[model samples]
Target: MTSAPKPISAIDLFCGAGGLSLGLKQAGIEVAAGFDFDESCRFPYEANIGARFVHADIAEVTAEHLEEIWDGAETRLLAGCAPCQPFSSHRRGADTSEESNWSLLEHFGRLVNETKPEFVTMENVVRLMRMPVFEQFVQGLEELGYTVDYRTVNGPLFGLAQTRRRLILVASRQGEINVPKGLGNGPATTVRDIISGLPVLENGQSDPTDPLHRARSLSPLNLKRMRASKPGGTWRDWPEALLAACHRKPSGQSFQSFYSRMEWDRPAPTITTQAYNFGTGRFGHPDQDRSLTLREAAMLQGFPVDYQFVPTGSKPTLSKVGKLIGNAVPPAFGRAVGQTFIRALAQSIEQGEPT
Candidate 1:
């Protein structure tokens, strides 16, 4: 009699609040364990993902440890979305290659070379594509006899309610695999589609039932600015006096997306770590005179409405939560990733066999 195939499992590196883990679970993949340096992620990852979460710096993680955590799953996946600040477009023109923290990508590459998991995946800011490190990672995988492919995908194309563009890479030692291209279907998801139903809140008001729905307080001057700000409109729409000194300068003209409002019919702008701050990007509400609520930011990032990022009663600090949400890979995109891997695995002739 033929033996049953061993189930596929994944070890998530830099798994923030378990977004990728949750999506993998949603796609029927077993998330064996998650690793990150943040202790705050333990509860949410374990609670929601029902998987083991190890709070440790990726720099300290070893391939042996990751394999041990794999627990003998015949088909294993190693996935990571290393912190991207060093490679972010915002820091362009300044060389960040020598920073010790940027070595996190090197660590990820080392683990892949050592562990040689059946599947490997990575996600990061699109700007990473231009970096030599990205070329090294892709070439290293190919040298290991793995078929590798990568692409830049827009969030809305993959069911996200925002327009985040990211670079996604997938490698398989078993067989040829491809990245999932979001089909340009009918209408893309929009802000109203995601957050229109939440209970309304004024600036500085919190929902009694769900504190995550609270909006950040806006100053009087900014409040008037928001009121005058049209959805998808720029800061130039404001009265000349309301414009910041920077806005008066020609250099600031290109920064029009800041302090604007999201259109109800379109996907939200990329959710940044400061998404709750009105002055950052087009985070203001479509009709309300305030910036996005915490929950709204999560929704735009493709997290569920009730997704838990903190302990039941522990306070959810806005900046921390924003960072967590902003740094997360959208669950919708994660689901697509999980689905694509599963599809490729099914056709993989290796089938966890000794090659």
Candidate 2:
């Protein structure tokens, strides 16, 4: 009898709050541990996922360190979404080669080159495909004998509640492997479908039962603007008297989504680090008059409702918790990647090939 495909375990780099790890575990992969520089991710990463969270700067992490933590499985994987701010479209038209965050992707490649894990996967903003670093990262894997495939994955296509697209790249040393294909079928999930049942909360109020459901307080003027705003509408919907100074400037014309409310029937705008603040993006609630709460944002990013992003007894603040939730890989998308890896591995094993 053929043995089951050797078990696969993962070490998630930059694992904020274990979003990706949770998805991998859901796909039947063991996430041995998670590594990140953010201390705040420790409790949430461990509390919810039951994996060790190593707090260390990725640039300083060596191949030996990864190997040390990458124990307990015959076949292993290295997965990460390195700091992506440097490659974001907002920074388009500028030379990003020298951005400090650029080195984080290189470090991800460096560790992969050095340790030579059997399988590897990475997720990042789609714009990264235009950068030379991405080409180099892919070339490095191919040169090391890894078969690589990558694609831009649409979030809502995969049941994530946001209108976001990320580049997912998977490399395997075992056999030919392809990134999963196709935009998902049929009527996609909507913001209301995912979060409307949440208990209503006024500005600055939190669900007493679920601390993460708290909303940030809105200013009186902003509150008025929110009340007048329509779903899927822009700042122009506001009365001229309520328009911000920037809204009058020609440059601000492009900031249409700023301080806007989400459409109940459509996927949400991309959740960002400052999503708790209404003026940051189209983050306002569909029916309420506040930006998406921590719980709402996390759920939009595909975190389970019970996922804990902070320690019990301590309330979560907007800045710290927002970064964790916004930066996470939507767990549903992560599960898709994990499922692809498993499918490829299964094909190899069924063919009497070693993985």
Highest TM-score, which number?
2
Q: What is the overall TM-score of model 2 with all chains considered together?
A: 0.94
For model 1, how does the per-residue alpha-carbon lDDT over 41-101 read when each residue is reduced to its tens digit? 7887888898999988776678889978887788999988988744322343555453433
lDDT, candidate 2, at 300: 88
328 Cα displacement, candidate 2 (Å)? 0.8
Per-residue lDDT tens digits for candidate 2, residues 52-115, read 8898887678988888887556778999998775433234355555444466788889999999
TM-score of each: 0.93, 0.94
Q: Give the clashing pairs for model 2.
A: none
Misplaced by over 4 Å in model 2 are 85-100, 353-355
Q: Which candidate is the best by lDDT?
A: 2
Error of 2 at 289 (Å): 2.1
The alpha-carbon lDDT assigned to residue 31 of candidate 1 equals 90
